[model samples]
Target chain A: MRNELNRVVMRFPSKSINEGLARSGAAAFASQLDPTLDELGDIRTAVSEAVTNAIVHGYKDEIGEVIMTMKLFEGDEIEIVISDKGCGIPDIDQARQPLYTTGGAERSGMGFTIMESFMDSLKIKSAEGKGTTVTMRKRLNTRRYR
Target chain B: MKLIHDMKGGLLTVRLEGELDHHCAMDITARICELIDALLPPRVRLDCSKMPFTDSSGIAVVMRSARAAQGIDSRFTVAGLCAQPMKVLRAAGVDRLVEIEEEVHI
Candidate 1:
């Protein structure tokens, strides 16, 4: 395990509007690591996907609390965890599959696929009626300057 | 998000400005579909040059737009996608569903 250098925890309502806030906040916090434009974009997109799942899938039609935790390690690595206490995923494998969604016609079902591709690693844990939690990690490329 | 539509000859071009996400996808998709259903143009084009950011929700917008255009027998094409949105679209294999062009001068 790398030494934990800094961390931030945010708690907000599981509203559709908060999706943008979550991703933008994640990008702002990740900027401390001096990530490049591509890295920042990847982080923002991954965060958006996870937060959207929590809001759209986890809580369903009801409003609940969505918690996000971001941690930075010694080696330019960042880890983000997004969790929601809502109706959990019945099948994690199926949910992770690309284009597989219960989110109706408006949903592309590509949330998990985008997150998995953009980040280095992804882990999801869920219980039928309990809740869902997603954790993702990525290490930015080392740069010569600063 | 802002949507600008230009209908010239048989082409209906809709320009998207601002971020496309779940928060705004519903309205955007509906507007585009409404336009397609009303105009029934021979060709439909989405200009994404000004759209700097998008999530999987953007995929839904694109897919819905494509479906709307298909309903009217209109050809659909997406042009001038920036890097991040393009990555998300390609990751979802959206290029296979609709015609994707890198840039458009006009």
Candidate 2:
């Protein structure tokens, strides 16, 4: 199933990361299948928030790379996995709280909240010494093909 | 996305074309804010006749624009929303904040 579907992988450094690239990447990735604008927008927002989290929270002042792995599932579900090998979040629970941010100027703390609002399912895994990984899934509301 | 602004009869009309998604929110936000600040008309109308689709982020941007309009005591009206974008906007409770009109001149 994975082989039959298309995949996109990207690695971006935190210092150079911005919203435009993240939005464009998700749009171009979803454009591979020519999805509806609403669906494409949903995917783009999720990707942007994930990448922003990596750039703002995960890396902070440290230099690191944020990797994104995207896969189309059975041509109906889109799954994206974003990982960053930077300073991991100490409290995953607090980080997911809406409007909870640690950084004063550089963060809005709505990244995860926005991602969760746009995607169907969101999963996060992190360790204090390791890194943070965010996996998001959304079902494409186009015609389903078996 | 493309934006065209017109001022007539002391009303500022903004015509938007193409998809309003997360990708275009920054530009849209900036343009709308600039127009509102610069023009300060009695009524500001958003003509979405050509808008095909919009997501939550797009809706949020519109909401923010409406709030900004309110802050300056300017009337905000969203017009010519198609079925799809209208459904999404209403479901998200955006229609409650901004006046939705069926007749909008582009």
* TM-score of every model versus the real structure: 0.97, 0.67
Q: Pick the candidate with the highest lDDT.
A: 1
lDDT string for model 2 (A1-146, tens) is 44348789987777533555666787787776667877776777677667767766788778788888888777477888999997889998999886588754324455677678778999999987678999998877673342
lDDT by residue (tens digit), candidate 1, A14-121: 999998899888999898877889999999999999998998899998999999999999988999999999999999999998889998667899999999999999
Give the per-residue Cα lDDT of candidate 1 at B103: 95
Instruction: Write the residue-wise lDDT of candidate 1 on B59-88 in tens digits.
Output: 999999999999888999999999999999
True contacts kept of 2: 0.00
Model 1 has a DockQ score of 0.86
| Candidate 2 deviant stretches above 4 angstroms | A1-6, A14-41, A56-64, A73-76, A86-91, A94-114, A127-131, A139-146, B1-3, B16-31, B48-60, B80-92
Candidate 1 displacement at residue B91 in angstroms: 0.6
The lDDT of each candidate is 0.93, 0.76
Error of 1 at A44 (Å): 0.5
CA lDDT, candidate 2, residue A74 = 73
DockQ class, candidate 2: incorrect
Q: Candidate 1 clashing pairs?
A: none
